[model samples]
Target: MYDSLWKALKKLPLLPRRLNYAKAPALRFLDLPEDIVYEIVHHLDIRSLCNLSLTCRQLYLSLLIPHLHQQKLPDPFREIHLNGDNCTAAIPALRLLLYDSPIKAFTWRAGHDPRTLVREVEQLRRLIARMSAIEYLELDFSNNWPANEFRHGHENGYWAWVRLATNLLHVVAQRCRVVVVTNHYQVLVPWVTFIGGVPYNLDPPLLARMCAEWRASAGEAEALGSTKLMKSPSKISLSHPDNAPASATFPQPFPPEKGSTVYATRRLIVNDPGLFQRSLFGEWALDWVSNMPLTHLVIHQGRMRLPLLRQLRLPRLTSLVISHG
Candidate 1:
């Protein structure tokens, strides 16, 4: 009977043997050991790291591991300039700023490509939306010079750039506490015109209309007692001599009892005394500085203008600095 059974089993084809060992669990991104994960993170830039953090909760937590802090990894994108040469990098920098870090101050210059101008302005608006407040903002749109004037053949083409800049300034000025520094005279002309400090007959009628609308909005904000719109700076340092504006006449200061205004600034630093001159840029800055309730005044690396210095009425003055040129 046993021989008969063995013969029957052999006739039935031999079955494959099943391994006794268990199958290994699938390897996952999050399942990687902590040190290996950190080693991968150390190789990533800020933009890449930000992207990785968005994948899953486990990976997000892994990025925040204390091992990173102990490692002291340097972030290369901390301060980025979206100027002409590096304009292509703006998108990545914008992503970094919008997602990873919030800069207190920002400076952007216009690129030669009119095609990207609208997109750049939109990106800036989006970035501004992400911030609660800005300390300082500078907009430089002077790159579209005579060489590129023909690129914008129609009068209306230029209006888009001007309007975008004006609108952004108004939006940011409401949340900015420090200063909106527009260094280029071409860009400054429109702002000065909006303030009625100077008359610039802009060729584009749309820009003029926009300026009028801006004036109305500013007046409305002031009338509505929107004091939180822009507060005076606590401390101001004017260091760039090259940014001083062309010379202009100045109106006599109003008597203190009549129409003098005081600002919240306690410290005033003028690294270049040339900024105190009677130029549109200098006067605009000094006009604001003259009203500061300063406790400290510092002048460095230039000949001090005693006459200009005398104009500052610092009732709370305690520290004065007049360093050698």
Candidate 2:
């Protein structure tokens, strides 16, 4: 009953009225220890953090502390999430953190504005320059790369992504846990649309190089110390059905044998018609992960490819899981 009450209070939307409830015995009844409160906030969901952050300045301060901020993060807050539409407000907060703090991870997505979309890549170069402590990183961009809005279309071309990718890879080569670059609705576009397109999506070579560097660095880290397991791309998918067809699945090989188990999902869910098996960004994801020395594969949703069983390979294979493959 006490745990339930505490959880309820933690999950409840905090308002000025509820802020007064900090003194209420319902919160104090359980008499949670100071360490435990910090643990709860650090390990709970982002919504829980939002609720607690609103409860009092102390709780807000607790959640942001460097040590506690790196605790066992819940599902919603664990991975960096930046929906395409929310990028504007999200970018500023991200910038402030990038400029002022050594963030553990940062997620990026282009918002609704066309200019912002065009300028985002440049913005990324600046952000990546300052955020050296980032361990986990995910970069998802909007497909709204407007043709008319381009400076002879060169300003918004794949070369722009090359600059962004170069800066990102240069800094991230030091200490990065996981990095994801994707387009939100990539699966919806047809393949031929990219033919003779001047490599006009993300810079595949840059990504390949980044993956190669990450593999090498992680190797050195393991060789020098006791290696930990690494897992991302889980088997269970939240967006797809339990019995989805095999053609729709593209599970990766087992994660590399280092770091804690991590689940990685780097694909798009297409709601529109004419959804292609591949992405507008090409097969960069599978190709990218195939190069990564990750282990313990886990995925939440999106189509799966079978080439992983044949063409692609991750030699570090260990535990393979498919919750909704």
Best by lDDT: 1
Residue 155 Cα positional deviation in candidate 2, in Å, after optimal superposition:
11
Clashes of 1: 0
TM-score of 1: 0.38
Runs in model 1 deviating more than 4 A are 1-21, 25-50, 56-104, 111-115, 144-146, 149-163, 181-325
Q: Given candidate 1, what's the lDDT at residue 189? A: 27
Please report the TM-score between candidate 2 and the true structure.
Answer: 0.36
lDDT of 1 by residue, 1-325 (tens): 9999999988997789987998898998777887898888878775687588768876655564332333332232233345554444434434433323333445566666645756676676656555544433445554444434434432333334444544454445444333323232333323222121111221234333433443334323312212232322212122222343556332322212213222333334433334455543344445455555455555542433567766666678887756552
Where is model 2 more than 4 Å wrong at Cα?
1-102, 140-175, 179-182, 187-287, 300-304, 317-325
Model 2 lowest lDDT segment of ten: 266-275
For candidate 1, the 10 contiguous residues with the lowest summed lDDT are 193-202
| C-alpha TM-score for every candidate | 0.38, 0.36
RMSD of each: 16.5, 22.1
Candidate 2 residue lDDT tens string, 1-325:
9999999899988676534435544567126887787666557564455555556666555444433224322222233445455443333333433233334455665554544544555555554554434445655543554444433433234333333333343333333455544543321132223212111334445445544555445424432211222223223233332356766763422323333322232211212111223542233334444554555343323344434335446677664433221
Superposition error at 218 for model 1 (Å): 21
